[model samples]
Target: MRRFCSVMLAGVIAGLGVGIGVKAHAQAAPLEVRVVVVTTFELGQDRGDMPGEFQHWVERYPLEQSFPAPGTEHGVLRYNAQDHVLGLVSGEGPSHMAAAITALALDPRFDLRHAYFILAGIAGVNPYKASLGSAAWARYVVNGGAAHLIDSREIPADWPDGFTPLQGHVPDEYPRPPLHSIAGDMAYQLRPSLVQWAYERTKAITLPDNAALQAHRHAYQDFPEALKPPHVMIGDTISSETYWLGARMNRWAERWVSYWTDHQGEMVTTAEEDIALCQALALQAKAGRVDAQRILILRTASNFDMPPTAITPATMLANAAHEENLPGLHAATDAAYRVASPIVRHLATDWARYKEHVP
Candidate 1:
């Protein structure tokens, strides 16, 4: 079934077959923005007027259209008619992401009715599932943030970790909030057809490789996938505000994703900003401003969720560059562009076919 858009037009004169009249109108034609790539942050952090951020996006889509509203951040809608993709930056973190998305959804500048939104960013990979520099297509986004943490040192002895679900209590108990309760359920399931479609397009593309990346990956020889170079895979993301570390926290994150998604999704990338992105998009969908199902999240791993067995958590954290692997960062970003470009191009070039029927 084709999902046809139903919008009331006010500016144009219709039915002019020898029996129509003209009407006074005062609005320019609504711009049709096909694809909106929402990236969290640009460059080495900080809010600056930088023209370049996404390497592949900047190189491929050089045509930049200024933002249409006031008070919103100064970002352009990058266009690549040749490739059929548009890009935007959502700033960073929970608050910034919420504001940036609200601006775009409510801006009254472009027609986002049929636009496909892609959330592309780097994240910490769960070594149990994948290796550094690998990219993943998420079917579920679980909010590892906004939790009721009691502190591992202070929590009940039997409880798995300090972090607990909203209104949830006790040791190893799943959240059992009231019926239709919106407090505890944080997992957002995106359109599966769209996820599969995007995954199929660029999964074969090789992610960037480097000696540093390989050396770090080698530490996890026990895990088969982590031993290989970065590759594309299907997984879920755990979005948390707390910069958590250690295997205990990793275990909690893994369980949190599964618990929220009903064991349907395996947690892969541990990153920030995804839940914020999901909430904003969900509201926009409810308002009939954008198609919620059209949104997809693609996260790449720049580092592992936790260090290997040989390295102590304290020792690993003490390392000068514990948070990010430079090589993995480059590889992940490179892989993000490679995996997303083809799907974006396909949607842009074949809009007529995918308009109502999701690929």
Candidate 2:
């Protein structure tokens, strides 16, 4: 029965255009690192690029040791023994994410059994729900790139959006694949209580808010809540490499989450790396190399998923760099660090408390 399901699922995944799986051999012992920081391009870039003191424990704890992935250039993993934190700079894409994680999982040097993995990065915010530079704790992560696309001109007139959730379908009518049936079959639901715990621990903290960001926020006045400065919230994420925008795409994002979670999901942030990272971790968990439930995703907004109505789509696309920088990349990164540091400190200082409890 299991083999039949796997073969049938493979055919479906091919049709959907999203491939899955990670190939890694089991090692003798898991890495002892208690906390692992998994970050995309920005966090994984050169250490000198870090704007301020707010950083992974790497800065204060300093790099105690480094493990160089054998077959790759600049794919070294750093560990801070003092704080029990490990860092991986997975380059910015699905491919790089899988490679980095596969290397670490198969390295045979680290016993990652009890390590708590934190997937943190900057994501485009749904301005209607969150402001620039706010941090969000995710309960559900969906792949925006998972959908089958039909050009707007090609799609049937009745279909409201150009995106079809899967092949041979129109908007709102895509078949719902059962769990483990295909790539992005179900929204990878993180541990709800852990998500709540992370948010409750950091929600009260202040985040980056500035006059320039406020002025930008003003443009989103129609989205009352987006007008506020950066803050912390618990929400869901949409992961896709394509930078989609506007009301049409916005509705698609919400629907995408709802489809995968069966009506319990909400799209709060848009990201490019979560699905890839989570998929890799899922593979590791299946091998007993890591605890899937220990993984947490925290995304801070560097820009909005859609520009305010005042801006034209063409202009929004042209000014992509400006939008990515307006709230200041530093501001978003800082917000993530602020909201996540205490959790880091708590875990490191009291590892025993979370060791067996898996909180």
Candidate 3:
């Protein structure tokens, strides 16, 4: 009986050791991500052939490991284990982006506490501010769709395209209700110092230019900025689910961005997902899952927000629908990767310094 009792005790102790080992392994399973590259969509497979927002990062980094992201749009996340870099596709629009980013942030498999997020994507450029294929580092991302709207035909003649701030009496109304009282999350302001640093680091990048892109720019001869070659610049983004085009809507976008940022932001790139992505990141930051200040938004112009001189909005839409790809699609994608890769590499390689202090 004494021998049997001793054996039983030994067996219990061994089981306890196994339990502790399993717990330790689980705790160590989570990846310590240093940098996250967030793209809005992927064309087909992650590699080979035509590149989408996610392809260049995938092929260039050679992300060899893949993990299932059940709820995300692409349903998978790519990882470069050696560099501790993650590539994610948040889907195409605001809803998809929010869901995917939120899911990723909440996942226990990734330790994002100190991770830097780079949202690189393509957008419609404001012809007056930027040319096709130009890249812009955003200082502010404003939600252009969060407002009261009236049909243009029914709106007061004095009103501009029938868009007004929530609970405001007029278009671009000021001294408005406090943010929390109304739709408080109308705009997200990134760290200006970081944005400036990124801009300075990449402003000299020469974007891809070809005869086709040049011809597109020539059509916008009236707009001096649109006629220039593709280049990197510091600008702001306006995000709306609706793909709006026309001079009147462009004016509305300009006003909306200016109003939300108190005239500190100029509308350069118009996109659909950045504001939603920012909102998710902000919430995750509040939850202590990620660092909001480390997020960088880079948008390259794939097309113009408004039709070029003499081209009607309907005609431009028709042309776009028939084309296999936008005029600046390739150029914009190349520029986005070229401009953002340096920052991503620096942060991932020198993580010891950036993990403690955001550069």
Candidate 4:
């Protein structure tokens, strides 16, 4: 039914002035390959080092784009191996990152069965509970910087906690609490089942021969049980523009003005593109395109929000080099993969069996 529906939809789209290639995309029920890993930044250890790593890996997969394959601007490597089709898209920021994920998910040929969206980049943290290298997952991603203030005049007189009655309530500068979304629930809820599947499958399957895969496998098996439901806060928080201005300024409250000018917010957290991806996956799951249980989101922290003078190159370098920080990220990334991989394998196996029965 799904295949028939998609094929019909593709035909309709094609007939309506859409390109022929796109119309032919629905010939089959889209490939139900396992495990699509996405990274906003490069698959490298740091911001400056992602391109080389990205370039080296793209060599493994043949690309469909006209431009030169991976290593070039926004080059992609799409492939299917061991029943799992993987996509590697590079660069950062929300708009680009979101588009990349959507592209990978919507590509009818790839059959992206189960997706693991790993926001593999650095992030700013609370600095106290969250250190430089600690791996935090977002149970609740708060959209801090993107909120609009509801003016006192526009607000009703009886809304709970409404500021209309306050003495100093400025009509223009009303404060509003931030909005939050539960990001990792789709991913987090699957952890235990995934881990169980991992242990069961480890005995029968041969692990991948790739260096990153092997390292990832080892890291997955060793994941600490305490760190479930990883906290990933997505927002514009870090900037170098304020680095030089630290010492000259005495008043700290005014420092936010400089950062807001550049980064657009003081510091906030929200899911990168997980919300939209989750929505898409939910649709796919309902349509029986992918196993909902096999999906997960893994993210790594990069930095901490601090006074301008506090953040130095040396500080960032030290944070990056900090044993706890990098190891935690490596561990968390590995943990997520370790758990999700087998669940993906299980779903793929089931899908393959189902395909055999289709005839």
Candidate 5:
């Protein structure tokens, strides 16, 4: 029965162009480091004021009426330098992120070698473990809601009571196969030499006093500029429309759901894009397409999916408002830009080895 269902699911995902298991060969020449940052909200006042740090690159490509498949309708920021080339797409979840990556990979312009993919955005954290303004560096991304209960569309009688067709299941144990944000094996491949290089580069960095840094004492004290250890990555796939229902399910589950509710005071269910993004990254690691040691996912925890005594539209709005404005949120965002730009810049500068690095 499970075998038959698996076949059907494969067909469905293929038809929808949703499953991203296949690899697309790069047509564009390879570059040093190919990095992709997927996010939601192209521009927003709450996140912080922006002279728009990536503006120069965006200006070079500018917005077109359209681009190409998967991303044909979306606005993409593309930049190509002698070092490396990158595409930054805005939008928060799995489908959008997968498509943008597909388009970029398939596009003749991008060189895929020695690539690093990053999903940077706001996330919901476990309240007890992290405060409002804390940042989490994901070591592995568990697909919290990737699996769904199967319902036979053809046989109405086969439908089980109390079960919604195609309804996603939230499992107790963290899902596997783990996506590698930091390629463990690959780090050793580039070890010693790369570590020495990194050491030399980081030796001069002066750690600035920041409130966000103070929050995660164990995580980032002496090495504010250094990449922190692996942390669990959970993507909020819950859409605004279904987030509440997801949150309620979270309450029943209690354990996993607390990560969401504790931050926002409500339940939000749905698979977030970063989860799948990280999953795809795991695939990349398996395929030997990217340098995992150089990759990292830096996210800010923003909402707690806890149910409130008095729930109202205004209350929900306030929760979201607070999530965005939280102290660590800005610090994480700023740190992401500050920390990531240099790596991207380094990859862009060294394009000669692009093909060898791209998976």
Candidate 6:
């Protein structure tokens, strides 16, 4: 009986040791991530009901794991463990985007050192460049909000508009001796090779079109590009917190992008969060938490930044306020997923090939 009791005690000790070892292993190693899909907002429940920028990814990729994401607009982050893909909603504006991205990057449960990030969302497209539902891969993301603004009525008659670059007395003035020395926060230039690769791969995709979209495009009869069917293109994005509209603002967006990129970028998509998102990612890259070169910004056209000739900007803005039934909303969301998913899948499935060298 004494021998039997001693053997039982020994067995219990061994089991306890194994349990502790497993727990320690789990605590020391974080989950490896391949790709992270970042979206701006969602309309309702993730699975059922109306779709937004995030719904298609969640339901289609079918992210099966839920991890608590404190301090984010959405309380939880979705994960597909099999594919090693994670989905995040950064809310609608710059503030929310900064907070959500920072929170995700700092989370202890994720290993993001080599993970690729894709910011896929909808934006107001420049009718002169692309039509509704078109997907654009941005090469440069310029901040339109970081400017010196004066009342249009009070500006000099010779000036183009009240907007000017920071520390500049006039519009479009080059502030520094070397243009490349401009503040890092003013703009983010993406890898041209990677941008070209993505654009080439997805440029031929045919985006969805309907009677409403057809009728809407017809209003922009003067703009040839707006009348064409939705397709993928390489364009730049301008981000501002204030949702400004009209022809004047459109022209400003074009000029802003040109000034920041030294005439290399053409503004196609206007959004509210990309600049802040980039800022956060850049900081994380500095901290050795992520790879900045692996970032990609994809925006689909949900609406036109300027109104048609027949309507005034005020009227168009008012109409857009009731965007739940907007015709381009669904098309843009679908296009974002269609255009971005191919790259995501390629990276996640062929991790061995792309883990060290970005393809």
User: By summed lDDT, which 10 consecutive residues of candidate 1 come out lowest?
Assistant: 1-10
lDDT of 4 by residue, 131-236 (tens): 3223333332222222233553666565322222122243223332222453322122323444243345443432123343233224223233212223322222
The digit string of per-residue lDDT tens for model 3 on 1-359 reads 99688667666866777434433553567899999999998778898878888899988866779999997779999999988999999998899999998999889899999999999999999999999999999999999878888888998888877888887768867786555553558998999998998999899888899999999899987899999999999999999999888898999999899988989999999999999988998888988999999989999999998897788999988777521467888898888899998888888998889989986
Candidate 1 C-alpha lDDT tens digits along 1-359: 12222122322325434323323224554567777777765664222233223645666544344344344453545565554456766666777777878888887756777888888888888889999888999999998875677977898777777876666665345544442455533888989988988888777887888898889888887678788878898899988877777788889998888877878989888888888888888889889888888888999887787888778767666662532333377677767777777777778778888767777
lDDT of 5 by residue, 1-359 (tens): 99688678777877898865422321334444355544544443312244222332344322222233344334645544443445565455566665665555555544454565554455544333443333444433333442333333542453332222122233322232232442221111112233344334433433233544355433423333222322222222222212332234443323333332333222222225555454444455565554455544545544434323345545554645543444345554443344445545554455455334431
Q: Please, what is the whole-model Cα lDDT of each candidate in the order they appear? A: 0.74, 0.75, 0.88, 0.38, 0.41, 0.89
Name the runs in model 4 displaced over 4 angstroms: 1-30, 43-73, 83-85, 113-119, 150-294, 307-359
Please tell me which predicted candidate would have the highest TM-score against the true structure. Answer: 3
In candidate 3, stretches whose alpha carbon ends up further than 4 angstroms from where it belongs are 1-20, 179-183
**By lDDT, who's the top model here?**
6
lDDT of 6 by residue, 1-359 (tens): 99688667666866777434433553568888999999999998888888998889988877878888888888889999988999999999999999998998899999999999999999999999999999999999999888889998999998878988777778878653233434588889987888888888898888999999999999999899999999999989999999988999999899889988889989999999999988999999999999999989999999999998979999998889655755599999999999999988888998998889886
lDDT of model 5, residue 147: 32
Better of 2 and 6 by lDDT: 6
Candidate 3 clashes: the total is 0
With candidate 5 superimposed using the best TM-score fit, by how many Å does residue 176's alpha carbon deviate from the native? 9.7
lDDT tens per residue, model 2, 9-93: 7778767877553112212445588887777764434456554212443554455577776654346777777777887677776
User: How far out, in Å, is residue 325 in model 2?
Assistant: 3.4
Output the better candidate (1/6) by lDDT: 6
Estimate TM-scores for all models: 0.85, 0.84, 0.93, 0.43, 0.50, 0.92
CA RMSD, predictions in order: 6.8, 12.7, 3.8, 13.4, 15.8, 4.2
Model 4 RMSD vs true structure? 13.4
User: Can you tell me which runs of candidate 2 are displaced by over 4 Å?
Assistant: 1-31, 43-45, 50-57, 60-64, 70-74, 178-186, 322-326
- Pairs in steric clash, model 2: 30-110, 30-111, 30-112, 31-110, 31-111, 31-112, 144-239
